[model samples]
Target: MPGYKTHMAGAAAVTGVAVAGIYWLGFYRPNFESMVCLGIFSILGGLFPDVDTDSKGRRFFYGAALLVDIFLIYKQQYRYAAILGFCALLPAIGSHRGWTHSWWAAILIPASVLVAPMVLLGLPWQPFVPYYLATVLGYFSHLILDGKF
Candidate 1:
């Protein structure tokens, strides 16, 4: 299986191709900041499937989650913090290559990027479509690299 660096590179390559295709088709044009955010999301998604195991991905995600959850709590955003806490525990609910590695998860898990802001901040879901797609693509790259797709 590919290591973290390989997975990250694969995700970046896939994301670049996808963005180029989208741009060529005149579908959307992302600015520099949006592109950077997309890359970040894709990289995170690429690493996420390994979060159930004792790997660098798990530590990075959990460490970041801990900091974010703490910030949310400090800001009195108890509901968001609770949600984050629950999500951070999800990977540990199954084995290393369990639900998190499934194709359905590749789609469904990323949908949170689209749904959460809509539900919590009353933001429109349409604006988050690219982010959702970027994450899914990254996740698919991981699956491909692992020969699971």
Candidate 2:
């Protein structure tokens, strides 16, 4: 348990520092509100495993991908993209990192995006690759803090 807590703390600090550094060093102006949000999310992601809260990160993280969802829905007839987003992020709201942390998710979660547009869309690597990477990165980060590492 102590190990878990220790790792969680490390995760928080690391995520925070990394985000903060990126925001500052990327040579872009750090918006005040965005800075605050980044800090909060970094902390939340770190502490995420302890509460076992459903996919809080997943639900919230998708905001960044909203445009992608909309794009897929409109351009590719992949309504499943949005549905996949919903399923992927929805269960996250209550599932906690433990359930979402499974290695199976790294594969299935992203692919699940195709479920809604099953007939309209063919599986493509373009979107799925980045989505899977992000999911795996965040999920694994949670698992590590939870001592599932």
Q: Compared with the true structure, what per-residue lDDT tens digits does model 2 show for residues 63-149?
A: 545766787778774765666466545544655445555656444544533342344555555533322333334444656555675
lDDT score, candidate 2: 0.49
Model 2, position 111: C-alpha lDDT score: 52
Q: List the residue pairs that clash in candidate 1.
A: none
Q: lDDT of candidate 1?
A: 0.92
- TM per candidate comes to 0.93, 0.38
After superposition, which runs of candidate 1 have C-alpha atoms over 4 Å from their true positions? Answer: none
lDDT scores in order: 0.92, 0.49
Q: For model 1, how does the per-residue alpha-carbon lDDT over 40-99 read when each residue is reduced to its tens digit?
A: 989988988999898888899899989989989999999999999998899889998899
Most accurate candidate by lDDT: 1
Model 1: worst 10 consecutive residues (lDDT sum): 112-121
* lDDT score for residue 8 of model 1: 95
How many clashing pairs in candidate 2? 9
